[model samples]
Target: MAAEPAMQMPSLEELQHWTWVFGQAQQMMLEQGLDMMAHMPGPAAMSHLFEPAAAFRATADFWSDTMTLWSRFLTQEPGAPLGEDAEQARDRRFRAPQWHEQPLFDFLRQSYLVIAEHMLKGVDALEGVDARHKEQLRFATRGFLDAMSPANFPATNPEVLEKIVETKGESLLKGLQHMLNDMARGQLTQTDPDAFEVGRNLATTPGKVVRRTPLYELIQYTPTTPDVLKMPVVIFPPWINRYYILDLTPEKSFIRWAVAQGATVFVVSWKSADASMKDVTWDDYVEGGQIDAIDTVRDLLGVESVHAVGYCVAGTTLAATLAVLAARGQADKVKSATFLTAQVDFSHAGDLSNFVDDEQLALIRSLSSDGYLDGRYMAATFNLLRGRDLIWSYVTNNYLLGKDYAPFELLYWNSDVTNLPAKWHLAYLTDLYRDNRMVEPGALSIGDTPIDLSSVKTPSYIQAGREDHIAPPESVWKLTEHFHGPMRFLLAGSGHIAGVVNPPSSGKYQYWTNGRRVKSLQTFLKGARETKGSWWPDWIAWLRGQDGQTVPAKGERIPGKGKLKSLCDAPGTYVRMR
Candidate 1:
């Protein structure tokens, strides 16, 4: 059989041209249809015009609001003077003295052409149209006007305009300096691949890796290697991001540390859901994903039970999976469950609540009716949550300073997002965020069983980050009360990702663990032991206690036929898909 040709995508310029052509075609069709309608005496065409006009006006107002948003952001900062050390440091590192022009020029050139093209069509549509269709054309015209308005385009803002005038020639020097620095540092991210090599060594010893599991394939880590672990640990990473984050580098990789300590580790690398996987839902994720993974590990390793660790949204799904397991009396398969900055409750979720309200949710529902939450939309929402850090800060650094943006590998990795199945996203928002249903005993049902976290009796480890805005300390720590387990609530010092990936080697990080069996987080932090160094050592020690002693011989080793077959090559799709 002959190989079919590969698919091709158009360049950005081609895409822009096609976009203009499509808009023009739509406008022509609407005009012809309107002319036909005017000739007729029905109200349907008139009604159509009204809805389109209203939508246009709404969009116009939206851009108008956006034009003013930056000013609001600037004012919102306390005293509006960059005095804080963190902010100052960021400015010094990113800001180039008197750098601003190319971006502003580029913005102006692009916006003018796009706005002019669309505005002209809108104007022609409205000019000699019957008064009956005027309202509809008015909206389309208004949108064009909004786009073309000086206030909305280019370096017209006082700060931006002034920067252009003041920092013309000096920016060239600064740009050159930055380029030299980046080149000296070995590319832009300063990523040391040596770190990966070191971590790989720490994780895989000589004659230890008997079989490597293929990426995105289900498999078990067994006793084939002499360095086999006693505690069977399976890590479920959030499909929203890459799984390798847990094992970013040698100094930072959590998986490497666990291996060194003799703990069997299994990690699920979720496939990036595409058009084919659109119909997948929250239930599918649990049953076909994490649950399937759990069963695979159990049967392959021949273990009575296994320990499961969930990160972020993965943690939320894990909680739901446990509820399903307990309801069906399959909870016996789980030895213990750990949640890392995971939320089962979302009643008072901070700023994110602002976006998940009725109007936005409705917009999402309408846009994602095709069964996949567009990854771009998800990225935009996350960008908004930390607008200062993700949006404006970069704008100031990149646009204001005529500096070429050097890619940070971490940020680059983060920008590479995976699609969320539309069904799963809607269910997640409605059931978990909008309704706060997961924590409720019977609000959620998996198959025929209702999930009751209180019924979950497995030993649990709940880690909440002190600085996690997405999953606040209070919101995440609340999971302890829901789980009727011998639980340990540890407060890590870093944000969501850093908190869990922490290896005691990183200096200045801390975590709190109360020696006494505390009832909840509020009480536990009161007299908790403030430990220094990495939380990795602490987690390892905790697992050591839970893990059975490592046996030296085959006779003493746990008897289990490793039945799980390798599905793909090592360093699977889960970690590198994005």
Candidate 2:
């Protein structure tokens, strides 16, 4: 047989685009697909049976490459690259020099890549399946392929093998201990969990809890500047996680940064839901969460209106609440709005679209034995989204290499999970994810008010992460059409958390912006120019543009001297909930 021509490979750019949740999602889709397939008796299952010829050809190619790698390894020169350097692979798993310098490890690494690439290409060739299930099968297959990589196990991983020998088997014992500790915690350890805590070192921004409701508590941060903007700012973070992410640490805290920039900041601290809070509906989150926070800010400060900000899930609900306010003739309550990596349209929702279907939603609903869905489960699901980074990487560090995870403020906050009330969770999944009703005006409502997104005329500063897994830039761009206000659509570097939380001091990443609206993200990119560093300063400048009136900072450091009596210190009681 003649030697074959080189296989056409996906560019590193193409591969990097899928990096967000590709590794973890690949596993998540497969595990969930099995159960979902049982209930989803549809043509998607038959998609696998389609394109059999291509699949067979790819399989043969995979085997051929594997055999070639094996044969080459049998007689290869020492310190020589085995066809390709695994170290050069874009994948972090194969970055170890041992993977490239050692022939056997290099073979294992290349063989795995060959298999994964072929499998992914074969999935792309699949036909006859609906687009949705086709994607599901693709991710599921990738998950399986990713999980079986030689680098995941100590025995097959040269780096891990070296660590074992260096420590004379003590590494193995420590790995078992780490595994046991994680087991006791009932979740995989991503960082040193004990190293940080809310208020003590994490959410240490000085502030006061001004308002508390059954659903949420509003924290009003003390001003770092003598005079604060007349229009105060209220932030509603996703109920799926705590609000402290915005206030992680002084240097990194967006909340702290905003206050120092002469803006009074109030953040919604959602009380983690429990069985007692099961009946809380999505409307409650709107009325009691964002709306209530807005109302509280106005009441506490004696201001007519304030600037509003929403993040992720809260951003979606913030838009929905704006729609409701529009319907109720109270849109003026919010002077302006800013959305951080938020979506108004789901049409372009990337890999996440696979998880929401009739069967899967029902299956998820069934898992909530209590009135609320455990935040831990949602956390795990999210971890699976970036499984290679959030899950497997830790497995290698804490278990395989028997090394301690560095004390990271962000990872600690990421580890903290919050539950979702059953009603709100189901409604969000069904109305938003399954049906994408947010884009369809009047298709959804809060309480009695119809959620007519077109009626939302509040000016918006919408910022999206170019690489956000939760809110793709395309989906966030769709938000421009939904709001009638003059909008600024910003495309920032990095993903959800890092992009929005980026502070000016650290000086990482960049952002793209265009004054004029474009037909699509691709078109927008053509007209946009990249500005290096954080989007925070641009956002602050915009905040100043909206009602730039300044007043002496209202709430003083004295406990009883402020206009509104302090309820508690910042990182309030609600966020402290498990």
Per-model TM values vs. the true structure? 0.65, 0.90
Worst 10 residues of 1 by lDDT: 202-211
TM-score of 1: 0.65
Model 1: colliding residue pairs:
214-568, 214-569, 215-572, 269-574, 504-534
Candidate 1 deviant stretches above 4 angstroms: 1-216, 219-225, 517-520, 551-561, 574-578
lDDT of each: 0.61, 0.79
lDDT string for model 1 (1-578, tens) is 99876535456565556445544543454454345434433334333443467447644643443333223332322222211244333433224332222332223233333343434444444433554334334433433333333333224433445546568746535535654664584333222223333225322321112133322443233344575555578888887876667655556667766766677777776776666666777777788778887886676556777889999999998988888888888887888888889998887565566566566788988877666666667766776665546655444444444445663435654565676777778778888887898888888887777888888877888898888878888888788778887888889897776677677776857998887876667788888888886677777677666776664424323222234334444454344443
Off by over 4 Å in 2: 1-44, 77-88, 555-563
